[model samples]
Each structure stands twice: as C-alpha cells, then as structure tokens.
Target: MVIKGLKHDAVAYNTMIGGFCRIGEVGKAEEFFREMGLSGVESSCVTFEHLISGYCQIGDVDSALLLYKDMCRKGLRPEGLTVDVVIRGLCGEKRVSEALEFLGVAMRNHEIAPKRKSYEFLIKGLCQEGRTEEALKLQAEMVGKGFEPNSEIYSAFIDANTKQGNDELAGMLKKEMAETQMPKKQE
Candidate 1:
C-alpha cells in the first residue's frame, strides 16, 4: 500500500497492522507503524492495540509493553484491548506479580478494569509457578471485583498444587471447586 501510494491514513495503516498481528509478524507490524509515522499518518489507540496484541501473542511482552508505554507517552489513551494484551503477555510469561501491578495501574490510572480472563490468566500463571498463596489472593480479588473465576483457572491451581506435592492445598482447592461449581477437568 505504501509502495503504491494508494492512500495513506491511520485507518489504512491500522488495517495493515492488524493483518500483520494476526499472522504473528509483530516485527513487521512495528516497521509498518514506523512507516505510518514517517508518512505523516497519525495513529490512534486502536493502532497501538493491534501492534501490542500481536507482540504479546508472539511472547514478546517486553516489546508489547514498550510499545504500550510509547503510546502513553505520546498522549494516546490505551484501550481495553491493549490492557488485555499486556495481561496476556505477562501471565503467559508467568509474571503474575507484574501483571497484577499493571492491572492496578490500568484500573486506577486508566479506568480500565481487567476482564475476567485477565484474572484467570494471572491466577493460572501463579498456580503453575507454585505460588498457591498468590493465586488464591488473586482469585479472591477477582471475585471481589465481581468477576467469576473460571473452571480452567481453578483447575490449574488444583493441578499445580498436586504436582508440587502440596496435597493439602490441592485438596483444599478441590473442595473449593466442588463448592463453587467449578469444573473437575479442563486442567
């Protein structure tokens, strides 16, 4: 599109960025964003979301967060989707503490409360890392925020505890699941 000079606009650049993200080509997406910058195309929140989501999908959370900070520094308000990607990346990397800290920032500074999946991912990651206490605390926080804990998250906690020889915590989680109507499988 840039080579052909068909029409350069934020929307067009965002569309291209979205396509690159879908294909897990975040590096290319970054290049496209730079091209958009050089071409005098002003970006929007959605533009940053697309690139951030792509980088997160590819396990490039550092890059995604860097882009996120850049968006903030440039005075572009981040949308919920951008926060979601950050949570996904942090949780996927087993960085639950960082994810939780960022979640707090999102809620306090940006008025973007995390979605249920965000909590789920954090809890799941903590559980996988054998941080049962942190996982339980996060689960409590999720429920306090009116978000229901999903079955998969509970199962991850249970399974992780079981694998770590923390039979007490595993049994406790199992009983909790039975009481809360969480699934027995799906771990």
Candidate 2:
C-alpha cells in the first residue's frame, strides 16, 4: 500500500499492526507502528493496544510495560481493555504484586476503572500464592466498589481460609456465597 502511495490513516495502520500481531510477527507490527508515527498519523488507543497485546502475547511483559508507560507519556489515557491486558499479562507472569501496584496507580490517577475480571484475576493469583489475607482485603475492596466476586473467587477464599485453619471465616464466606446464590464448591 505504501508502494502504491495510498494514504494510510490510523485505522489502516492499526489494521496492519493487528494483522502482524495476530500472526505473531510483533517485530513487523512494531516497525509499522513506528512508521505510522513517522508518517504523521496520530496513534490512537487502538494503535497502542495492538502493540501492547502483541508484546504481552510474546511473553515480553517488560516491553508491554514500557509501551504502557510510553502511552501515558503521550497523554493517551488507557482504556479498561488496555489495563486488563497488562494486568492479566502481569498475573500470568506471577507478578501479581506488580499488577496490584499498577492497578492502584491507575485507579488513583483516574486513568481507568478496572473491570471485575481484573480484580478476580488478582484475587485468584493472591490466593494461589497463599496470600489469603490480601486476597480477602482485595475482595472486600471489590465489593465496596459495587462489584460482586464470582463463585470461583469465593471458592478460592473459602479454600484458602480453611487450609489456614480459619474455619469460622471459611464458614462465613460459604454462607455469603449461598446467600448470593453462587454455586457450591466442588468436593
């Protein structure tokens, strides 16, 4: 297209980047992204999103983080999906603490309103690491923000509490789950 002198806009650039990323050609995608910027095409959130997702998919979380920082430096406010991608990638890498910290900064700056899934992922990760107290605290914060934890998250908390000999807390969570009609934990 560039050879034909076709005018490429942000959407066209984003499409090319997304295509390359989909095929796991993140380097090419990044190349085109840079070209898009140099061509005076204004990069939108979608542009950054495609590249960020590509980096994350390739397990280059540091690159993804750097890209996120670049996006912020460009005054581009990240959307929920962007934040979710980074958070999920961090969690997948077992960097749950960093994910939580990033989320805190983003929320405090009013940059993004995290979806319930993000919290759930963090909660699950924390529970898996036996950080039950922190997980419970995060769940409480999620509830205070009007987001209901799902059955799996409740199950994790219950299991973690039970394993730690906090049977009373586990029972209380089970009762709350029942009241909310959440499915019972599988034996």
Provide the TM-score for each candidate, comma-separated: 0.85, 0.85
After superposition, candidate 2 runs with Cα above 4 Å error:
162-179, 182-187
lDDT of 1: 0.85
List pairs with backbone clashes in candidate 1. Answer: none
N/CA/C clash count, model 1:
0
What TM-score quantifies how close candidate 2 is to the native fold? 0.85
> In model 1, which range of ten residues has the least summed lDDT?
178-187
lDDT of 1 at 95: 83
Assess the local accuracy of residue 162 in candidate 2 as a C-alpha lDDT between 0 and 100: 86
Lowest lDDT 10-residue stretch of candidate 2: 106-115
- Over all chains combined, what TM-score does candidate 1 have? 0.85
* Candidate 2: residue 7 Cα off by (Å): 2.1
- The residue-level lDDT of candidate 1 at 63 comes to 85
lDDT of each: 0.85, 0.89
